[model samples]
Target: MATYDWLFSTLGLEQWCGASGGSAPTSLSDLAAQSRGETGEQAVDIWELPFPSMDALNDACPAFPQSRELTLGLEEGFLDIKDTLSVVLDPITQPLSWALDAALYGILNTPWWIVIPLLLAITWAVSRSWGLLAFVAACILGLAFIDHYDYAMQTLAIIFVCAFICVLFGVPIGIGMSRSDTMQNATIPILDMLQTLPPFVYLIPLIFLFSVTEPKLYGIAIILYAIVPVIRLTNLGIRMVDKNVIEAADAFGMTDRQKLFGVQIPLALPNIMAGVNQTIMMSLAMVVIASLVSAPGLGVLVLRGIRNLELGVGLVAGLGIVLLAVILDRVTKASLARINATHKA
Candidate 1:
């Protein structure tokens, strides 16, 4: 007898329980026991309750649904809408694929001599610190020495393209949020969801939406994962600007545009830069995960190491990633410091 048998019979559910046929329906445990040449009486134990499951319930009534059916239905529903989604999303996202491919090609094909000096010059220009310039140069040269330069560049190229797009779109959305309480209230929930979701979860829907061979597949994932910080910080930085300063701008007969660009944005630059720093780091982290969908870079080496059990390969690639992270972090922080110093002056 099933665990719910007594209740079913008491409730006059004998037909549903298959007991109207003059015998109670045996549970799965009973059938298993019989198959094993043991009677239900021998296998039954009070200590081990035989819980009625979906399978047992379905056995009593073939019309009832099972758990697997629920999952199958969900999958079928998604598949039904996938093509329609792709039609709308593909063209809109195609530019991202082009940009990613172009960046990767340009970075990989560029000679190290040119890339290294140009990076050092940019670092010096941004920070105006010889120390930072030297450190960045050293890190780049070290990766080159280890023959990881190309892979490192591949990773940087992806970050460069995706992070640029994140900032481009995130800043405006943030500014909108800062200017309107209603916008902020509506957007906060979305930003919270994006920030808290697991990194791998970003790729699952994308995988179904586009083929893995497409560059935008991974580009979208990296952007979605890394964009939250920039938007949040941009909004915070703008809103945190001193009201007195804004009032002074108003006294000068400045319009909202002038107040924003000349006063709020300049004052908010430091926080915005900090957000950029975090966005870059998050971009790098997601780039590695995006490699699961064919994002080229040091991540491919790392994944290969895991798949093939090659510890040295994984360790070296990981070290290269750490070096890259340090390089980016220092450059952005130094730039932020410069902005703050200029603001104070």
Candidate 2:
């Protein structure tokens, strides 16, 4: 009775025993042993765990903590390029690093009141059209008006660096893709992986490979997240070149390489530019999440707002990002148009 009470109460098995006022064997092992000796209708199963034999007992738990160092050994030695390239990039990338830091410093040092009017003037000058200029002005002032300028600039800095690098690398790769089928085939899958992976997931591997303070930390993540569209558009634009144009170049006795350089790439410039515009936009989008990893600028404000539940702070910083994205998109699209018009003329 004592065993029955403990077993029933402890395992909550009394519910299964129900009607007969809860009289049953106290243990699964006792039932199992009795089941073997019982014959015909007297048999029963007290356990849900299917066991063909005693093998099931030890097989239930998982084995782990298997240290590879003790069990087998390191799989081959480390490759030299991985470590060598890190050292080389650390020194050679100084100029780019300083430019970004300078941009951030420039914004941080300026007073909010001074920065607002300066921003409005710059927007008006670059945009030229009154409405475009006002829209740009309002966006900048709205961020500052709501007290978000500083954080916004940090986001701007990251995007500025990353997008510039994307164009720097993406345009050339796109041009190359336009010229070669093998390269496009090899490159597209990698781009697809980059595009498809969740943004948060990119930081995990990056954390191991580089410190949070490193410039390339955010630079590489932004590049990886943003490179796809530009490269694809570059490839598409080049491939979309009219066959007649190619034939005309050939008829002019232009070599294959010459034809590609002179004609196909120029024709595809719009698509390549469109890709760049998208890359810049994506780099801006990443700033907020990148803030968690010590990325500076507007996202830091956004992070602060969220961390403290400061609604005003988060909303304003977010608005600043919108302003920056619009300005960048407009500037890039305008440049693409000017380039295309020149090419056509």
Candidate 3:
């Protein structure tokens, strides 16, 4: 006799139990074992903890649902809305795919010699530091020597696109937030959630929203994961701009737009730069994770290494990522330093 049979009989639930369509179990102690495909005849030890499975409850009464049913219901619910979400989201996000594809194509097809020299020149122009220029050159050259140059470039191309979009849209949002307390209140919670969420979680909704073959599948994930820092810092920077400076601009008959452009943004440049720096780093980090959804670059190599148990492959790809990160960090920081110096002077 099942342990719950007496209770069911006492409660006039025999009819309900008959309708449940579950097999009889000797006792609640057997629920976990039954769920695991084990025999349910074993006795429960007094010292052991008991976990009554939802299936066990269902066996006792038809009204009770099994755990699997709940999970299945959730899956069915998401599936019901999945098509609607894709229809609404696909057109709006298609351009992101185009930009990412273009970047990957341009970077991959360009010869190393042309790409390397152009990068060095851009670095030199931005930082005005020959030492930094050389370091950046060395890092890229090192990746090329290892035959990891293409992989590195793929990673960089994604970062270049995602980070640019992040700043383009994120800065305006930050500016809006900085100008209004209500907006700030509404935005802070979202930023907090995005910043704190696990990197992999960013991919889950995107995976369902877009096909895995699409570039925007991972592109969306990388952007969502990396964009938070720039927005938060941009807001902080603008709000931190000195009130006296703002008043000074006002006294000179500067309009709100002029004050923002001439006074506020200029003073806030350093913080904004810092945010860009962080956003770039975060982009790099997510690119690796995004590889799971078909993101190209060193991350693909890294993921391959992990999947195939190739220690050397993983290590080399990881080193390539490190080199890329250093090159990016140094370049951005040097640029930031130049901005700070110009402001101080």
Candidate 4:
């Protein structure tokens, strides 16, 4: 603020906005309308949006790629992405979608008597620990008792699906990066951009390319946002393996493939698992933001509570998310611990 004030006062740059010599009757209004994208009649004044200097931006990187595919993707689907996605991904997305739609429908239509125990039992069973089971159950029942079950389910659905996909996609990439310096260097910048970006920022360009209706819209956002840790950690894990062990494998006259699979990757499992844990946590965090674009979850409830000023609803739903996070974190950590311990012993 002080620097801006200094600049405004010292340079007399305020004249650009026309306080003394440039002020016009409808200058601000015209600027506002243009900013708002209002032509003859579109939107009202919205001057807060940033204006990209087209020539200057293009000058920096003159050979900008044409976005015809991007535009077509938005309009229909990019190179039959919908059909391709449907054929390749529908089997997985469909079931989860079914589960979510079923869960939501069940929550809104069915009695609390059914929802609470089901969420509790399922969470406990997955964690495979009595204490974690009880804790998760308590969290679920507490959320339900407070009437936050619907939002909780919405969040859970996204987390489950996105986390699964993240691990599925990330592990292979991590493995590849670990094996090749070229791959690692190539991928690091892309991952950096994904991980360092603000959670909400992921939604912007995505919004231009896809509407709220497509399941893949938020799904892609969730994966991209959560994928960084797994890939990095997987690479790190593999790289961090004992040189002695790798040499020992080499002494056996093993190939690089055998060494990686038999020694490096096994040793790296703990780090990879930790990465998966982080990925899941990140996926949960993104799901909440993704709800802004219609990715359902406990986030939707939080949003609802915010929009309607339903304090209790938001509080209970938020608590459900905390409970979910704890269960996931603990189970994943414990699993990794057991694997590491067994390896050591």
Q: Across residues 104-168, which tens digit of lDDT does each residue of candidate 2 receive? A: 78778877777667766665554455776677677776666665666776677678777887888
User: Model 3 off-target regions past 4 Å?
Assistant: 1-62, 65-71
For model 1, the superposed segments whose C-alpha errors exceed 4 Å read 1-30, 33-64
> Which model scores highest in TM-score?
1
* 174-228: candidate 4 lDDT, tens digit per residue: 9999889999999999999998989788787666555567666788789899989
Model 4 segments beyond 4 Å from truth?
A: 1-128
Best by lDDT: 1
TM-scores for the candidates: 0.87, 0.70, 0.85, 0.67
Off by over 4 Å in 2: 1-96, 106-128, 255-257, 337-345
Better of 3 and 4 by TM-score: 3
CA lDDT of every candidate: 0.87, 0.71, 0.87, 0.71
Per-residue alpha-carbon lDDT of candidate 3 for residues 1-345, written as tens digits (9 for 90 to 100): 233444677888778667433465545655776888875345645665334577656555656677989989987887899999899899988999999999999998988889989999989988999899888888898889889989999999999999999999899999999999999999999989998999888787777778999999998888888898899999999999988988889999999999989999999999999999999999998989999999999999999999999999999999989988998999999999999998872
The per-candidate count of clashes, in order, stands at 0, 5, 0, 4
**Which pairs clash in model 2?**
151-298, 152-298, 154-297, 155-297, 155-298
- Candidate that beats the other on TM-score, 1 or 2, i.e. the better one: 1
Q: Give one digit per residue, the lDDT tens place, for model 1 in 260-304.
A: 899888898888889899999999999889999999999999999
